[model samples]
Target chain A: MSWLWGAVIFWLAAWAFNVWLANRPVARSRAVQLFIPALFGVTLLILWEGIVRGLDVPGVILPAPSAIWATIRASLPVLAGDFVQTILKGALSGYLIGCGAAVLTAIAIDRSPFLQRGLLPIGNFVAALPIVGIAPILVMWFGFDWQSKAAVVVVMVFFPVLVNTVAGLAASERMQRDLMATWGASYWQTLVKLRLPAAMPFIFNGLKIATTLALIGAIVAEFFGSPTRGMGFRISTAVGQLSLDMVWAEIAVAALAGSAFYGVVALIEKGVTFWHPSQRGRT
Target chain B: MKDTAGIATPVIEAKGMGLTFETNDGPVHALKDVNLTVGKGEFVSFIGPSGCGKTTFLRAIAALEHPTEGTLTVNGMTPDAARQARAYGYVFQAAGLYPWRTIAGNIRLPLEIMGFSRDEQEERVERVLALVDLDGFGRKFPWQLSGGMQQRASIARALAFDADILLMDEPFGALDEIVRDRLNEEVLKLWARTEKTIGFVTHSIPEAVYLSTRIVVMSPRPGRITDVIESPLPKDRPLDIRDSPEFIAIAHRVREGLRAGHGDEV
Candidate 1:
């Protein structure tokens, strides 16, 4: 009871301090900008730790943040292996292949009205298929390894990038196209110089969306069948063994990896599209 | 060889030209029975109200639009063939500069497409940037510049290729009055320097009178030319030339021609 009350008091005090800090002129500074979110995260951890200990909750159901942290530290090597197997080998490779193929297909189909009409609907249908339905089939075809997981990820990411890139290729204005025509620009030249650059904003939108899907597909597909070493495999086994801390640790890793993936793409987007109105006027 | 006499060969020629757009509302006559000739080194203006097909005519010359009836030619070849030959540079109502590129890069775009050498591309970009008085703004993105400056950058882009014909469709229409006036002055100077055959479209009577050696007055509703007035204004025009009697007379005749077109509609 004292632990619960102590947590409540601390939460209110921290909340008040954050509000005061937010109102201060220094809040706009870069250090304070970073500090506020870090502080809020710490406060949540503290509250979770206090509440779990105070309630004396069973570890099999829910582990404390500290327990999860401890498990993460203890299983560093295992976690690193899982990270490499699932994220790096499966998700990253699929993302590169899927995005590359989609962009190429978009350009190829752009010249043909027949293919654009025929292919886009097929892509949409593929995108709509249930992941569970396809995962096991892919696992059988590709065998029980990271390859199957990558195949699932490729299926999940292809449609968005294809649709976005096609839409992006058509994004150049009619006047701009007319100017190209006046200059007697070859179709290849126009595609390389104008259409490709114009399509970048839309392509990045698709790419950013694909990063999250890539990770989720890779992890979830591992559930159908994996080589007994991925994050998904570890998570399932740990759950069956009633080590909730290990499951929480994997969740933490997934969350961090997902965020870092998204952040890197968004940073690249900012760099590539610095001239865009949405990206301009920042420090 | 085509010039049997001393008469300068016409750069653009149209005879009984008509363009009809097939829309859901049935065929709309955008241009009809339009006959005009723009000679080499001539500055011609097409002026009228909205839907008068002034822009349509310009687009036809650029081969961006095709005439359903009659003939149109640029430099003695078909408009399409002339476009293929890269005989002209076109400027739109808006600047239409690529947002991702700097001003200099935008100017270099046509040069790159036309397969100019690296040294030549750099040289032409510099020349046009200076010609449009946007010299120091070469590295700035389109959005970083003022609207007037962006329009000038676009002009520089059109000038970079040094095409013999410059087709402008109300290029300064979106700008404010003061910017428009300043741009008008600069355009005259540019025309003087380059001596390119120019076809300018505008809605303003003063703009037509000030810029053109000939003004083609047009009207809407099965858009056709109402009158064609030859300007007697000398080649060397100062800003104050607008106050002169000759300038006002040409402006008044253009106004009357426009009003007569409207009078027929009413």
Candidate 2:
């Protein structure tokens, strides 16, 4: 059979197996339920691996998972160095700055009507400004270091968090406010006791959304200009050298890190704003 | 408790109280010329049709709202002053329990806000929870309990501060008759024990007559009070009081007053 025929047979068999497994009743244990998705993921990798080799496709078009894993194994120190430089130094710092600025801005916007009218338009403008444009400017301003990557992340993440938090602050209904009023609560007391607590779910939403944006910004901004140690720089250089497996390894690291960051924010959100319906949907 | 008929001074008095709002269409007169008085420790039930300002009148007294034009006094002070002094506790139509907190936590909220010590909050929360006959459901979330239990938790929240007055807006109107009757009896018992002046708003005629020392009948659409009938019931009312002829008579008078208030020109 031709390589395309072989690929088709494997794909069909895998699809049939997945459908059969999905039809069975859910497992009694939480571990088993989690394992099902992992099983499917491994099967997908196997299918991808079989098809790529069977077709005699060039490495540039698609590298097999084993080749990617082998590249990761061969370059652990390089991968670790990039992970530390891009994620810890660049993304984490940017996430803190961007989310911090957004929250302070949101609190200010929530406090004064004047800022809400003046600043939200500016945020909308910032949100519209593409990272492709800002990354180069940030690189120029902050120099070709992790600082520049962090600056790029600040630009990418500031708006979504601000807007969501502003909306959350406005979410307290009339009766709730009236309850505070009847208690003769002072402005600071009302804000600290009621509005801030009420606004938490929205604030965390912005934080969670900003995590991925921070990662993307840190990685993409590095592509504009950076020392040779970062993920974006490595991936670009690897691509130039036709080492496609290295690019895949870097991408895997990014996916894992981004998901972990997002998960942490979501977990904190569950703790802080457990009252919200979005949190209720988790159970 | 004294009958307090034609007392020398009213514990609460509202004179020419009115509230108006300007909508896009025109002015909306929500309340107009609402005059009322309650003697010390009186249980005044405000009975009216929906949209009547029974709840609004209660809110105005609680200072949750400001009447456009009125001179009002509760405990011989302005509504704002009274609210600052923690003169009254209010139970809203909805239980309005915070979803984040457990039942005991919800009960402790008012005490916490009022700057009571932690020990005081715990003590009062326990006392009020038992007062509402919820002895052991403290750790449960609001969603875990039925609607009646949630409302009881809210009532416990309102009562935790030991306010001299209780403002209840349709507090038991949501419950089934069986639960309503049980709660009604419990309220009377609490009133007897504490002598708290309760201003209750409800649409149920029997509920109004069964628990109140007075019934303030209200009208809607530019809401105003139509009548204030004194209840003939003694201070120590019980569950069986609902079957009394005196309760029926007061309910009849409240119904008549409600009808008379409706369709009356401003």
Candidate 3:
């Protein structure tokens, strides 16, 4: 009861403080802006821990945040192995290969209308297929290892990258193309100098989308088949043993990894497309 | 000047030239049986109403649009061949600068494509930047600059290759009157300095009169040339010369020619 009361009172105080800070002129400062979100996140974790402990909830049903954090610290080696198996080996490799192949395919399709008509429909069909159904087949083909998970990730991420890159290649204006032609620019020259640069914003859009899909596909495919390792394998096994805290720990790792992955891509996009209206400062 | 035919083999020549666009609505005669010749170091302005083939003729000369009926040659070669030869530079109505690139990079683009040495490219970029009075602004991106300055950068890009002929399609059409007048003066000075043959397209009568050694007045609805007014004004012109009687008379004639063309349409 005391735990419950403490969490409730702290949450209310934090909420009031956030409201006050948001209204102040000092809120516009960078440190204050960052502090607000950090404070909100801490409050949520404290409330979650308080609710679990105060009610004397069974750990098997829902683990407390503190318990999950403890598990994370204790199972560092296992978690590190899982991160390398799933994130580094499976998701990262698939992301690079899938995105590279997609860009190359997009350029090939752009070169020929025949391929554009033939390949785009096939890509759409492939994209429409269920990941669950394809994952089992891919696991059997690539075998029960990180390779199969990588294949699944490739399948999941390929279409989004292809479609976005194709659209991006066409993003250049007619006036820009005409200028290229007037300069007697060759096809490759026009592509490298004008169309490709023009298409970068679109390409980055695809790449960012592929990052999330890579993680999801890599994790999900492991459920169909995998060795006695990886995030998905650990999560499935941990749940069966009623070790929900370990499951929560794995989830925490996934969330952090996913967010960090997305943040890195977004940072690169800001650097590449600083000229775009969306990226520029209002002033 | 007209009688000096054998002197230098005209810079651009068209004989019974025409272009008919095969749109979904059927064939539209964008140009019909046009004939014109531009000599070396001459500034020629093509002026007419909206539907007139002023822009079409310029595009045809640039090899962007093909003439359907007859022959059009640039620098003693077909327009396409001349384009391949890098015989001319073209400036469009809009600046069309790539947003990703700085002004200096945009100017260097054509030079890169044509395979100029790196040192020469840098030298040419600096010279043209100064040529357009954008001396210190090369490192700035296109979006950071005003519309007038961007247009000037585009002009610098066209001039970078040092092509003998400059084909400009309503280059100052989007600018305010003050900017247009200022750019018009700069263009005259550029032409005088470079001694490049210029083919200018515009709808403004005063702009046509003030800038051209010759004005080709065209009419639409089966677009054709109606008048070719050669200015008797001397090569050396000051901005105040626009207030002269000769300038007003040329402007009034251009207006009358435009009205006569409109009379045919309605």
Candidate 4:
């Protein structure tokens, strides 16, 4: 009862603070923007801690935030291993391979009318396939290692990147192409100089989307099979052992990793596509 | 300069040139029996109502669109061969400068494609930037510039490669009247400096009269040349020249030519 009251008060306080911040006339500096979200996150954790501890909730049902934090601190080596296995070995490698292959395939499709007509529909079909439906089969085919996880990530990521890149390749304006033609630019030269550069914004959009997809695929693929190590494997085993704190800790790592991955890609996009209208500010 | 007859060979020659586009609504004749010759260092403007194939004719000269019948040549070569030889620079209706590139980079595009040395590209880029009066704006992106400035940067780009012929399809049509007038004066000065044969397309009577040594007026619906008016105005033209009697007379003739073309439609 006290926990519920504390939660209500905290929620109201946080909400009022956020509303006040939102209405303020002060410049929305980068620090303020970041501070608001960080404050909200901290408030939520504090409320979570207060509610769980005050209510004396069973550890199996929902561990307190403090317990989760403790678990994270205590199991650094193990968490680092899972991070390396799931993120470094599986997601990163698969993201690179899948995105590279998709870009190459998109270029091929752009070059040939026949392939564009034939392959895009097939790519769409492949993208529609459920990850769960394909994960087990990939695990069986590639054996229950990081390779199978990478394969699942690849399958999950390939189509989006391919479709976006193909669209981007055709994104050059008609006048721009005519200008190239007037210069007597060869097909290859035009592709290199005009189409490819013009495609960067769209291609970055696809890459940003693929980053999260890769992480999700890698983590989820390990649910089917993994080599006694990985965030997914530990999460599954932690539940059976009734170590809810461990599960929460794994979730925290995954969330952080996913966010970092996306942030890095977005930063790169901002750098590369600074000329784009969408990326106009902060030269 | 007006007496181009029996001088050096005409820079562009079109004989019975026609183009019919096959559309869903049946064949649309964009140009028909277009006969014209543009002499060396001449500034020729084509004026007509919409769908009169003025742009199509300019595009045909650029080898961007093929003429279905008759013949057109640039500098004694077929349009395609002349394009391959990089005989001309073309400016579209909109200033189609790539947004990703700076003004200097846009100007250097043709030079890079033509395999000009880096030093030569830099020199030409500087010269053309000065020509267009966008000297300090070379480092700015296209989107950062105003529409008029962007168009000037595009003109700088066209002038960079030093092509003997420049084909412009309503290049200043999108600008406001003030910017258009300023650019018109600059274009005259550019022509005087470069002496390149220019084929300009415009819908404005005053624009045609003020800019061209000769204005070829055409009608729509099976587009064909209706009349050609030779401007007797002097080479040096000020913005106030449009108020001159000679300029007004040429403008009136162009207006009459345009009305006659529209009357044929009615």
Which fraction of the native contacts appears in each prediction? 0.89, 0.42, 0.76, 0.79
Query: Candidate 3's C-alpha lDDT?
Result: 0.93
- lDDT string, candidate 2, B1-266, tens digits: 22345754577888888987679999878789977778777788888887787777888899877888978888889998999999888898889887778899878777777899999989998999999989999999898899899988888888888998999999888889998888888888888888888899989888888888778777888787777787778887777777889877777787777777775643
TM-scores of the candidates in the order shown? 0.97, 0.94, 0.98, 0.96
Q: Write the per-residue lDDT of candidate 3 for residues B88-170, one digit (tens) a residue.
A: 99999999999999999999999999999999999999999999999999999999999999999999999999999999999
Q: Enumerate the chain B TM-scores of all models.
A: 0.96, 0.93, 0.97, 0.96
Please give the TM-score of chain B in predicted model 1.
0.96
All-Cα superposition RMSD per candidate: 2.1, 2.7, 1.5, 2.0
Top candidate on TM-score is 3
Question: What is the C-alpha local distance difference test score of each model?
Answer: 0.92, 0.84, 0.93, 0.91
Q: Quote the lDDT for A274 in model 1.
A: 85
TM-score of 1: 0.97
lDDT tens digits, residue span A160-184, model 2: 9889988988877777777777666
The list of candidate 4 runs beyond 4 A from truth reads A1-8, A21-27, A281-283, B1-7, B264-266
> What are the chain A TM-scores for all the models, listed individually?
0.98, 0.92, 0.98, 0.94
Can you tell me which runs of candidate 2 are displaced by over 4 Å?
A1-26, A281-283, B1-9, B264-266
What's the ranking of the predictions by lDDT, best on top? 3, 1, 4, 2
Candidate 1 chain A weakest lDDT stretch, 10 residues: A274-283
Residue ranges of candidate 3 with Cα displaced over 4 Å: B1-8, B264-266
Comparing candidate 1 with candidate 2, which one achieves the higher lDDT?
A: 1
Error of 3 at B75 (Å): 0.7
- What tens-digit string does per-residue lDDT give for candidate 1 at A122-188? 9899999999999999999999899998899999999999999999999999999999999999899
What alpha-carbon RMSD in Å does predicted model 4 have with respect to the real structure?
Answer: 2.0
